[model samples]
Target: MGCVSRRTQCAPRDTRFPRSQLLQELARYTWPGNVRELRNIVERLLLLTGDAIDAATVRQVLPGRRPSTSGEAGSGTLANRVATFERDVVLQELAAHGHRVTETARALGLERSHLYKKCQQLGIDLKTERTQP
Candidate 1:
């Protein structure tokens, strides 16, 4: 998050794009085109938006698309937003590695113990997730 702020500091003056909201919108989007298309969209966003770029700006930049409101971003306190993002990322990594705690921890650059603690904190039922199809 700090890194995102640092990078966006170099953006056009007064640009107020929040990284979590932006990331939420991006993740919800289904890119029909490839990396080049993503680059173009980002460039377009930078060029088109004024002082602040929030969810509405993102919607305008990507026409005909309505981002889901079910996402955990853009409607909470900062800590809740961060927790939601962390939970999603950890869940994804765990699923990707077939719920192997050590593998998931290594993939996320976390110690196995830390991952377990995180899962516990996030209320992620590993046994339940693992048992699911």
Candidate 2:
């Protein structure tokens, strides 16, 4: 399962703020589909916002409030971080192949063997999903 390509904008982070501070901006983050998706968001934010950007600015642009799988209402944990990454990868692949495994592997520049390996590592089950028409 993949996405139809679309363009959207996201907010910037404050450089004067510490990394920990940005982490506090959890309320500001949108769960973008993939690493590329998230990177694009961060890049847009870095380019558009100045040194003092904060959470309020982020909330304005990001769709839906950031969900708190964080357990502590903003405390991002190691498990949560891993899950986010896995979700993104699955979404990215789903988008690329029009939701077809053979197509998705090619789109990702991966061989069938490697793709299967990745699916195993990422815990994605292609069989459960309906293929693209």
Candidate 3:
């Protein structure tokens, strides 16, 4: 893909990229260059695609990677998808902070109690998490 500048010919249109599929595709990528590279690829995908951004568009933007399965997009409702994403992020942060609730909450920009509430809502058993080897 070419450099994604302001003049990238991307007219304002409603691009329907399903978050569940998009997130799955993004998570599957190795992203050797890290967050910056991921951001650039996303920008390119948005600027290059017409109307909608699907698995094919993602594959074109990110060659060599296997396209996500069709069923991934229909896995759940938008609220469920968002909850899954949030839960995954919370778990990752908790792991990074060695299961310290306070530290995980701080890193996630949430109050400690709020983090506990979030974990409860997400059905994450924090008691078990703390005891994991």
Output the TM-score of candidate 1: 0.49
Query: Best candidate per lDDT, number?
Result: 1
Off by over 4 Å in 2: 1-80, 131-133
- What lDDT tens digits, residue by residue, belong to model 2 across residues 1-133? 0211122222222244344444556424656576666555455445434443455434433445544433465457778666764555555556544677777666455787887787877676767544433
Clash pairs detected, candidate 2:
1-94, 2-94, 2-95, 3-95, 11-45, 12-45
Q: How well is each residue in 1-133 modelled by candidate 3, as lDDT tens digits?
A: 2233232345354545565676666667776775568767877667544345566556646745633333475478789867875776687678768999998887677899999999999999999988987
- Count residue pairs with overlapping backbones in model 3: 0
Indicate the residue-level lDDT of 79 in model 1. 85
Query: Candidate order by lDDT, highest to lowest?
Result: 1, 3, 2
Q: Per-residue CA lDDT of candidate 1, range 1-103, in tens?
A: 3433444666867666777887677667787877666666666666544345576656645644734334542688778766875777687667767989998
Candidate 1, which ten residues in sequence have the lowest lDDT sum? 64-73
* Better-scoring candidate (TM-score), 2 or 3: 3
TM-score of 3: 0.49
